[model samples]
Target: MSDPTPVFDDLRDESDELDRLVAELSPGQWALPTPAPNWTVAHQIAHLAWTDHSALLAVTDADAFRGLVEKALAAAETFVDEGAETGARLPSAELLARWRQGRAELDRALRASRPGARFPWYGPPMSAASMATGRIMETWAHGQDVADTLGVVRAPTDRLKHVVRIGVRARDFAFGAHGLPAPAEEFRVEILGPSGDTWTYGPEDAPQRVTGPALDFCLLVTQRAHRADLAVRAEGPDADRWLDIAQAFAGPPGGGRSPKGDAE
Candidate 1:
């Protein structure tokens, strides 16, 4: 089995990168609206904090985590926004502090878990590595929203590997979420990473294929950018459809972003 320490280290770096973006923001800046409809910069951080808190509970207290799951199941649609809304209402400093503390606690809990132990999540059980990957994907995606709102262009890093991996792995979940059966045959996916190295998945000779820049694929799976605005291409019918519904994060299909240059 692969060591999960590197992934956990990457998770911390990803979180810190995002922290740098908002650490110095003024209260008014915290109120600045992000690309996610009705979500401000504060809302983005609040959501991450909320999720980290949930993750902490999942790792350290199963019963409490189950309670959270029940709460979410009861209000599948509103619970996410409700959590963000509640946290977003806190004063900026308090919110920032809470987010930092929660994620720190979560990191420690994940590192301290027994080997091979798995924890429940919204979609399925996950090992510590899988949990870290999911958190990094979300951090990057929401960070994109905050960056776009601030007109900042974040430099892409190899940390995107985690996001790309989750995106590729979630292909079947993406289809299933939309009530479609997953294609039986695997589709090849090749993406050019930020460093110009190609990241490839599935059989090379597979009839279906997707090829694109890694950044585009990550943005696509996260639904942070509209498909029309991305460079990802699909060579077969199933692969083509996969791009349309691809989502890295768990939950119902999201109402994706409007195309670039289109009115919101």
Candidate 2:
């Protein structure tokens, strides 16, 4: 029918999931080491919370927000220069509370926004809906990192389709940004989410098929795990190549190495 509305529904859906996950965890589990090296679960969640706050600033003041990102990146680079693992440690309870507050503030900001309100982000300007969807993808990516670390699992949800769709669209952007040929053919991407939800992207009759568990797809796209580390399969070369460097989220190319079995 009409173009799919990417708005309040996706935003609310993703926001509810994130808040639910954080609220459900045991305090001790919050500090568990996630897939991100030297970053515990708390760190990952804290980053989400912090990003929401940053997004709000961008919505309110574009220049100030850009300055915020630059300043934060500069400090982060300094820490990375000193030691790859360097980070500010936080007390457990406080970190969790901070995450809760930041997310709450973000939700409030989104709910209050007027239609056509624009916000600057890591990529092109975003509307309130786009802002929320981006946050949803971020939560799932990091949630996988957390779930992977604990040996626990997150069931797939239909909402994953949004993340997959975004990732698929970004595939071409990733290639073009790197001075590579834009894939002219379509690909079929199917993720069997933990909840038994299968999301399909690309042209229906395309030659390629990228199929796997939702968690695995998210991990591969996020660069948190090598393709080999997950149960992933690609039927064609272009599909394989796209899977190799899928930067679904915005910002610079992550430049992380692809895993062994994937993109080989």
- Candidate 1 Cα outliers beyond 4 Å, as residue runs: none
- The alpha-carbon deviation from the true structure for residue 123 of candidate 1, after best TM-score superposition, in angstroms, is 1.7
TM-score per candidate: 0.98, 0.78
Cα lDDT over the full model 1: 0.94
Question: Which pairs clash (backbone N, Cα, C closer than 3 Å) in model 1?
Answer: none
lDDT of 2 by residue, 1-264 (tens): 222245546655665665566666776777676656667777777677667777778776788888876875777544322321221256656666776776777777777877777787766888887787787888778777766667766666777766766777788887876678988877787778667766777777878889998767777777777776788899988878877777786655675545655645
Q: What TM value does model 2 have?
A: 0.78
lDDT of each: 0.94, 0.70
Query: In candidate 2, where is summed lDDT lowest over 10 consecutive residues?
Result: 79-88
Best by TM-score: 1
Write down the RMSD of all candidates, one decimal each. 1.0, 4.5
The Cα error of candidate 2 at residue 77, in Å, is: 4.4
